[model samples]
Target: MAIYRKLEKEDKEKLVGIFQQPSAMYDYREFDEDALIADENCNCIVIENDGEIAGFASFITYRVPTKGLVGRIEDVIVDEKYRGQGLGRGVMEKIIEIAKEKKVSLIDLTSNPKRAAARKLYESLGFEIHDTGVFRLKIK
Candidate 1:
């Protein structure tokens, strides 16, 4: 079984182990736990199985003039070895809890269309695909 907890800076080693391609998981060589904790509106949590990181998810809540408070779930992942065990659900549930606690009016996320399983999970959580355009310039 996987146990869920808030992420900490010290969990870097265990977290890195969960990603097959570390580059895809994170852009930096080191996990910046300090930055995450210091951020006022972001919450991150991790799932541990037998003292190892099984999965993780993060969300950021922001206030917009027109939309009120909103949250976006990001970096959701479960180790390939731990996928079938409902670890992803555990992580997402935690994110939803945080969103509710923060009084966020809406929460959203984006997943690759190829990730059918991911889309299903989000749907099960009551997320609907908003027919909106998502554009990025990719400045980097």
Candidate 2:
């Protein structure tokens, strides 16, 4: 059975392994477990299969004047060895449950066009592509 729950300090190493997979597109950052666990606005989930970490995901919730509380999911990934076992869906479902509990008015996520499977999963969970442009500026 898979266990889905909030990220724990001991999970950092295994979570890092998942992000290091070639399929993970984002620029890797050193995880500050203390900050992550202490942040009131961040909700993170880790999936454990037979006592080993199988996947990880997280979302940040904040209040917007117009939208009220909104959530943006980030860094969702399943270990390469565990793909196709519904662990991704399991983690995402857990995030959605947290969002609902927080009364999030909207939730958003971004995926590279190459991530067809991830896109399909999001759609299956009722996420729609909004007609908006995403822009980023990297500042050191």
Candidate 3:
């Protein structure tokens, strides 16, 4: 079983373990905890299994003139050992609860097309494919 809670600096190593999985889509060698928490809108959460990190999820809510309030979910990942156990859904449920409290008009996230399981999970959670052009320029 996994218990979900707000992320903390002490979770750094355990979180690294979870992120080591391929589905995470990023080679995150380290986490900038101070920088993240410095942002008042950051909501990072972790799932723990027997004192070890089993999953991660995060979201940020903000308002704009055109869109009102919206929440963007970020970097949701579960350790390979914890997959198919509903841990991902559990983490997303927590995000939704918080997003509701924040009164967000929408909650959004992006998943790699190769991640079929993840896409199915998101769909089961009531998330639909929103047609939009997601572009990025690697400035570095």
Q: Which candidate should be chosen as best, given lDDT against the real structure?
A: 2
Quote each prediction's TM-score. 0.84, 0.90, 0.86
| Candidate 2 local lDDT, residue 84 | 96
CA lDDT of each candidate?
0.74, 0.81, 0.77
Question: For residues 33-136, what per-residue lDDT tens digits would candidate 3 score against the true structure?
Answer: 87776776889888887777888988887886877787888788888887888898999888888888877877777777887887888788777786672211
Task: Please count the clashing residue pairs in each candidate, in the order shown.
Answer: 0, 0, 0
- Write model 2 residue lDDT over 8-126, tens digit each, in one string: 88888777777888888455575888899999899888889888888888889888798778888888888899999999998888887888888887787888788889888988887
Model 3: pairs clashing at backbone N, Cα or C within 3 Å: none
Cα displacement (angstroms), candidate 1, residue 42, comes to: 1.2
Better model by lDDT, 1 or 2?
2
Cα lDDT tens digits for candidate 1, 1-140: 67888778887777776654542354436458898878878787888988887877888878879777888887788888777788888888877777778877778677778777878888887777866622111101
The Cα error of candidate 2 at residue 47, in Å, is 0.8
Task: Please give the RMSD to the true structure for each candidate, in Å.
Answer: 5.7, 5.6, 5.8
**lDDT of candidate 2?**
0.81
Order the candidates by lDDT, highest first: 2, 3, 1
Worst 10 residues of 3 by lDDT: 131-140
Q: What's the true lDDT of residue 48 in model 2?
A: 90
Candidate 1 worst ten-residue window by lDDT? 131-140
